[model samples]
Target: MPVPTRKRSPFLTLLPWPERKALAEALRTETVGGLVLLAAAVIALVWANSPWSHSYETVRETHFGISALGLNLSVGHWTSDGLLTLFFLVAGVELKRELVVGELRTPAAAALPVVAAVCGMIVPAVLYVVVAGGGGGSLEGWAVPMATDIAFALAVLAVISTSLPSALRAFLLTLAVVDDLGAIFVIAVFFTSDLNILALLGALAGLVVFYILQRKRVRGWWWYVPLGVVTWGLMYNGGIHATVAGVAMGLILRATADDGTDGRKAEAMSPGDRTAHLLRPYSAAIAVPLFALFAAGVSVSLASLGDVFTRPEPLGVVLGLVVGKTLGIFCGTYLAARFTRARLNPDLSWADVFALSVLAGIGFTVALLIGELAFPDGAVAGHVKAAVLCGSLISAALAALLLKRRDRVYRRLCEVENRDDDADGIPDVYQQGQGEAK
Candidate 1:
């Protein structure tokens, strides 16, 4: 008898329906947001190169801040340093959920993505060092390619991978969650300057209070909103990226269930989940696009284009994203499945993994942020930003080509699987003794 394909998942843990739906919706929202971000980038690019370029720069450099809080960031800084925190908060929540209740909860489920993500980060930094640092160039940009923009990657995948194995998307999600964590660690550890111990202590104290509130099953936005703001500000004053505070607050939130008056139950949605759902749309539509507008507006010229490839640092960024990410991710997953006890999901092919690995190279949002941090001077930073955009576009195009080909192959496989049926002439998915269809 032919085996049924509908219900079996040898390697991936299928999430409950509600969680699955939420994850799907979140991906969809981010996918659309990616398109909007692209539009914003285009607008910025055009505006920067236009005769009105001075106006764009004037607007970006305009300063506005709360005097008492000691925050007087420029408009561009407001977008990157302030508005981008929403994105970090949502990412942190997703990471927490995955660790607590999703595939990453178990070592078996985590092994492949964890290995892939770690190598994905390490190889890029190594490649950047080889290209840039080896020449005695500044090594500050090494971490720029260590990120994979989830929205951009997912948008590309969704466009050309309709028939790919479901496990592939799951793998990308977990891999990206781990990638985001790596990026966050790099920003906090390396980008920070002029550490303020008092402000740092204040942020820690705020987080402690937040944890206590959650433990007490506290409710209402009033308790959390102001506290989160204060903590974020304190983190900024502490000379750390303020976005770290968002991640801290998100991690402190309970993931298994909401802090409701009701007893702890498996069925209840978590506060973190609830918050993520509410904030994700705002983050995707407004926060990210805004950041791209400010961060991606590089003054385009033939000279800058040439510099991206000719200069050590900029060329290193391009190679890190285009070459290092693909090699790192594909080789990492391959090594894990071969040498370790881990097994690849039977439903997905090595071809699919390769295509997905290519897709993981779209490092836009955090890449820009890191490039900004690495090179504060406008001229060099513009060249680096151009490199990131060019590299990401090339990766997206290559991944789309490969995934579309794999999608055709998987479509044929799925058609074959759908034909298998029981003696009763029913589809195997609905046959007797089969588990209820998910």
Candidate 2:
């Protein structure tokens, strides 16, 4: 006999508008993503140390490949080189969206973070270059600290509830987006070693074709997936980093079919609203989470710790991420605000700015990715991983402490001001009678 299936209740969805809005907003915020990443990190640590550690290592490193049509890569390489291209594509889409309509929409809105991101990227790279300048292998990992992992940084923010104002959170997010943009550019230009000119041309042609498809109102992403794979193959062979194919493909596909000046897609009824509605869920849910799971796992051990600190390349990375990131971000933002007419977030005091700067130093995910790219060999890679983890922890701690202190100060000031206002409101005769009674 067939069993009765439970009917899904539509009443479960009949909540008030405000409740629905709150739920949506909570989901959109970085909180859920942060929790997911934190869980992944914990799991990675556990897996690395457990008796099944060999299984974890074997699964991650075991070579799986598809060579049927001249394309070749191991399972780990495919995950990093192929799948991660999609991740970067999603990142590129978000960057474009932000610049076009979101937080980085205007020069004033974009300036402070752009400047800060530049400094943040430049200073750490310079620090790494300085520390590693004399060595033969050291120079290869210049881009190691030139990233801000949005997931890890946001996770740190999630843990420290009162350290940042809402506006400051917006500011950090913008800066991180800009930071990612810079890192993409760096990877495309610098890290690539070999050049397959014909493949490069093919990649460019694929982008053009994708652009035309977008212009013709192709909405289904599946249509472009094969072309994107071709683009990735071309880039992989073209001496450009394979991940760059993701960015290039994203730029073409995400171009809104809308007319820019009127802020509406001429073809769509609801203006910019419809386009955003379509892309938002895809970007936030599927793309970002898949990227996190694919990119986050790294083996941890007591022996690995010793190798991490003693190696110059990884040591430089740690210092650059911890020291360079905080100082560079703080100085860049502060200086930009001081010199320019860009208005500061009303809720953020100087103390809050400094705290946010420290939070910006949490560079775990992106830094680790860079380390992987910069050092493919196992020897120094372990050190780089250690540095990223240590630096991020230090930054998170410092930011949390500073933010908590600033919150306390703010509360005290508010209390004092409230007392003054109360005293002023009391009548002089009433006050004198009260004093006499006392």
**Best candidate per TM-score, number?**
1
Find the candidate with the highest lDDT and give its number: 1
The collision pairs in model 1 are none
Model 2 lDDT per residue over 359-394, tens place = 888886667777778888776776777678777778
Model 2 steric clash pairs: 194-239
Instruction: State each model's C-alpha RMSD to the native.
Output: 11.4, 7.1
Tell me the TM-score of each prediction against the true structure. 0.89, 0.79
lDDT of 1 at 359: 92
Local error of candidate 2 at residue 339 (angstroms): 3.7
Summed over model 1, clashes come to 0
Query: What is the C-alpha local distance difference test score of candidate 1?
Result: 0.89
